[model samples]
Target: MQSVGKPTGSLDPKRHLWVLGLLAPASALLPSQLVTHTGLAFFWWIGPIIVLIVIPTLDRLIGDDGTNPRDEDYERLSNDRYYRWCTYLFLPIQLIGLIIASAMWAGDDLSLADKFGLAATLGFVSGIGINAAHELGHRVEHLERWLAKVALAQSGYGHFFVEHNRGHHVRVATPEDPASARLGESLWEFLPRSVIGGFRSAVALERERLGRLGKRWFDPRNHILQAWAMTLALFATLTLLFGPQVLPWLLLQAVIGAALLETVNYVEHYGLLRERRANGLYRRCSARDSWNSDRLVTNVFLFHLQRHSDHHANPGRRYQTLRSSAQAPQLPAGYATMIVLAAIPPLWRSVMDKRVLAHYEGDITKANVLPRKRRRLLAVRRAVA
Candidate 1:
């Protein structure tokens, strides 16, 4: 299948910046209402519907075809200036939203819908938005890296900063990587695997980083210890201000966000695998390695996250510049819809298994091609069942 081209219409960074900034205010809206009067349950749904569905639809309508591509001379702009501003501006938006939500919880009368809405906003901002920022932060610039950490801090997932860039990306699609979903693995199966695996990988990475600096796991300089300290501090602060009730809600939001991320993971590499070489190393990830989505609506809301093929091919490319590749596997729908489908395990397996088989068949037709590693994973899983 031919991959879709980059957006071809007017492309304005200002528009995206504005939309991202608006997230804080949008999230703050229902919470602000909840603090004063606890009965506006209906308004909670409004924020998510508008954010996850309505706004994305509108973005598609407007279209961000790269009509006004960044000038070649744009590289001369100080990377530090851009990174600091993005971090300083966007990071506070999430923090402000979180504060408002926590305050609302402290108030007496909160409708169930209001609580749900708060959770939804947190999930989007922290999970999807922050995660995207983390990916962007890893660009080859000092400023972007700082902004990425700020984004991660907002989500309470700061370990991702170290683990993703230094750990997950390096080990992706391998059994050792928590972020990678195995072929034929159900969404239900992928969750605990990702969560537990991710945590373990983070610890392992911290140890390695520390070992290089002549420190041990318990050393004060240990990043893993530092991450735990930060997490504990956050919990203590929330417990003191908002009471224990806030903890469950916070975890709920995080779970929702993490699950959304994993669902995307499942779709992106389902039943796809690299070939093992004579030296027992998997082939390097290429454009054809990942599933790509180019649907206009999803791409905009996700900050072009669906351009997975390009991302794997060129990890340092900016979201604005990532292109689709014909060699990559294509998703049937946007990430949001696919996420929903993935929740239904039977339906997800049925739909995706056919796609996997087809891709494998195509590979088999090529001369001198070897069986993909994903095929072995799937076969092993089936045998175990």
Candidate 2:
């Protein structure tokens, strides 16, 4: 077996497999086809079933390949248009799936359960598509950035393009970073805070940028509004074409997609903190500040997002070249499993709290605790001392 740390040289062994990135959106539509032929309502939920169950199971069985590309290979891999096209393909497929879902919702034959199952299925696709957008949004290319917003339209999370690159990447793992979940914060609490705070921060960051360029805060040049306009136009056009019957389900799926995206946000930096200097500046982000998982299936599905520690260190790095870090904290499993764990607060805390505490060398003060829980954590710390 190849050592996890050893580079496999110039050729990326996984080169041809990248087309699997489209598997999520395309496979999701497959079940609806099955439903059409077999009249099985359960087919609608296949997307969620695959994400919540199959992916995690496959992750466990396949395990992490853990091949960090040789430094020499980075340029070649990053410049590979093949990988870029794989991600670019997701946008059209995702949009088509949403349209198909709308057509289904517009039909009268489906039961309410079937309707929600289909909604959830598409929600999973759109939520994962946000990961694709994250990959695209970080690039210097103009077309990729535009497609990133198009991918986000299904989730109604267009603000993510501005906030993630500017706000989350800039302040990640710090107390001021709303995207980073605190030690005592559950997925439920973190979702609304991150989602709302991110939107506000994106607007402010864009306004500040525009102001320096002599543009108004609400100027047409604000890319944040541009992204939102794409979403609004998409929803309006879909409603007009599919009729009002598809509108409510469209909104429902959007909520689920956004919720899933925020849940991943909750997982990425839970309880991690970047120390501030005496001069009041936070330390520069490094691998240790973000969670890392090398699970191969998820690394593929999410386009190497689970190699998150490297991502923070190289925010603009192409996903194809993102490396696994030996120093970064490792999750017990891939994001597929951890995301499920995060949804249940007690389970999330039970599994992750000890890791955070250990990462800080058992010093509770070093972790970012939820504000209200700090006193209680300190009391327990004193008792242990």
Residue-level lDDT tens digits of model 2 in 18-90: 7887998886578778988998878889888888899999998998866778888888888879999999999
* Top candidate when judged by lDDT against the true structure: 2
Candidate 2 positional error at 209, Å? 1.6
User: What are the Cα lDDT values of the candidates?
Assistant: 0.63, 0.88
Q: Can you write out model 1's per-residue Cα lDDT over 154-208, one digit (the tens) per residue?
A: 4566677677777767766566566766555778878887777777778888888
Q: Give lDDT for model 2.
A: 0.88
- The TM-scores of all predictions, comma-separated, are 0.79, 0.97
Clashing pairs in 1: 3-326, 7-65, 7-66, 8-65, 9-65
Clashing pairs in 2: none
Task: Name the TM-score of candidate 2.
Answer: 0.97
**Lowest lDDT 10-mer window, candidate 2?**
1-10
